[model samples]
Target: MIIKEYRIILPISMEEYPIAHSYTTTAVIRQDLALGDDIEISKSEPVTNIRLPDGKRTSGHFVHKVYHLRRQVPKWAKVLAPKELLVLHEKTWNAFPYSRTEFSNPEFLKEKLSLRLDSICAPDRGTSENIHCLTPAELAQREIIYLDIAGEQIPRKEYKAECDPKIYRSTRTGRGPLVGDWQHSVSPVMCCYKLMTMDFKWLGLQDKVEKYAYEAERKVFCQFYRQMFCWIDQWYGLTQADVRAMEEDTCRQSCSRANRPQGLFGSKSAVLLPARAARLVPESKSLSLPLDPSTGF
Candidate 1:
C-alpha cells in the first residue's frame, strides 16, 4: 500500500491536527522508527529529499541512537528533589527526546552508567543557577540536532567571523553553536535558513523569528511514538495488561465478510399416496364425526 507523500503541507490540516501533522519528511522517518515499520536504513541512502526555501533540494540522513529508559519513572522524579539525588540519561541528539535513570541516589546511576542529564538545556537559556533538573516543559523545548546525510557540515559564520581588534571587541550572545532539531518535520525551513545564513541582514523578520523560534521549542513535547523516548505516544505508557486487552479486542472485532452461496430456487413438488383396496377401521361404540371429509365414518 502506498502512503501519499506531499511536497508542501496543507494549511487546513495543520489547523486541524497541529500536534500530529508534520511537513518535515523526518517526521515520517520518526514515525517509521517509532512504529517499527519495515524500512531499510543505509548510510548511503538519504532519509528524505528536502526542498530548501530557495528551491534548492537536499537530502537528510538518519542518525541511529539508542537509550535504555526505565519502564517505571523514579518515585521522586515527580516531586521536588536535590540535584545531587537525580540522574538523567540524556539523548543521542541532546534534544527533545531523552530518558533518565531512576535511583534514590543521583550519583549512583552516573557512576554505574557513566551518564548524567545534560547540565544545560540550551546554551543561551541555561537552567537555574542552583539546579539543572529539567521540567517536562523544559525538555520539550530541547532540540535533537541531526547531521546532514551527505556529511555537508553547515557552519555558523556570523558567530565565527574574526573581529577587528584595533577598532572594537566583538561580543557573542549565544553560548555555543546552534543545537537541536533545526529543520525537523512539522517545522518551517525558512527559520533554519535564516539562522544558518551569512552576513545577510533583512527586515520584517522579528515577529516571524520570534514566532517560529517558540514553535521550535516544544513545550510538553513527547516523541515516544516515533523514537526511543516518546513522551506522549499512547504506546509509551502501555502496560502488559493494556497489550492483552488490545489483542482480545482485536480478535473480537475481526470477522470474515466473504459472500455466501445463494440458495437455489425450485418449484414445489406434488405428493401422492397409494390407493387401498379395503378400509381397515375399528368402529367406536360412541359415534364420532369424521374430522376429514375424505374419511368415511
Candidate 2:
C-alpha cells in the first residue's frame, strides 16, 4: 500500500462575516486510493452547521463538505499485480462561506443601549458597518491552532496559504487598466503533514487482507490526532497534563467570558494560571527510536 499526505491552508477572508465568536473554520484534507491503472475517491458526510436565532427565523450553514469514490479490481487483474502500489496523485482545496449574517430589531438594540447608559454614560451606537476586519499582519499573529500530520519539521514551501483574491479583483475593477504585460503572484501558506505506520496483524483479519489494508489506512490517518496533541504540547512548551488542564479550564470559563461585552477590561487570572503551570513542568527530554528496517507494506 502507498499513502501520501497533504496540508492545506484556507483563506480567512473568504468568509463573509469573520466575527470573533463565529464558528472556527478549517481547511479540508483529502485522500485518494490508487492501485496499478485504477484510482478511486473516498467520501465522508458533511459536518452540520451551528444554528443561530435571528429574531423569528432560524438560520444555519455548513462549513465543510467531503466526497469519496471507489472501484473494485477485476479477478484477472490480480495475475499482474505489482509487489507494492504507488500513490501518484494528491491535492487539497480551501473551503469558505459564501454568505453569513445575523439580524435583530431596533428594539433589541435600544434595550441594550439603555442598559449600558444606565450602568455608565451614553454609549456609541453600534451598527453592522462597524464590523472589524483583520489585517494580514493581525491574522498572521494568531495561531493556526490545528494541524494534522507528523514530522520533526516540514518546510513552509510544501503548503499554500489561503489569501483573499477579492481584494485584487476589486482593485482591477476600479483601475480598468489596459496592461501590456502584468504579473500576479500570491504568498504561500505553511502547513505540515504526518505519516504513521501501525501493525495490522493485531486486528486478526488476515483472511480478508484487502479489506484490512483499507481499515489499517484509516486507523493510521486517525492517529494524526495523537500527533497533533504532541505537536501542540511541544509548540506551546506545555506538558501533557498542563494542556489537559488548560482545555478543561477554557471550557469552564468560556460562558462567563462570553457574557462580557467585547473589548471590555477583564482579568487575565484564568489565562495566566496554565502558563505558569506549564513553565514549572520539565520537558520529557527523550529521543524516539528510528523506524524498523524490516517494516513494509
The model with the greatest TM-score is 2
Over the stretch 182-210, how does candidate 2's per-residue lDDT look in tens digits? 11212111222212111223233323543
Separately for all candidates shown, the number of backbone clashes (residues 3 or more apart, or on different chains) is 9, 10
Error of 1 at 200 (Å): 11
Name the runs in model 2 displaced over 4 angstroms: 1-3, 9-188, 202-250, 253-297
lDDT by residue for model 1 (1-297), tens: 001100111111211121221111122222222222111101111233433323444443222111122211234432533443333321111111111111112353333322212211112211222223334654454343322211222245512122111122213211111123322432212111001110112245334433432332211011111111121233333444554444333222221111212111111111111111000110100011110001000
> What are the C-alpha RMSDs, in order, of all predicted structures?
34.4, 25.7
Candidate 2: count the clashes. 10
Scored against the true structure, residue 263 in model 2 reaches a CA lDDT of: 19
lDDT of each: 0.21, 0.21
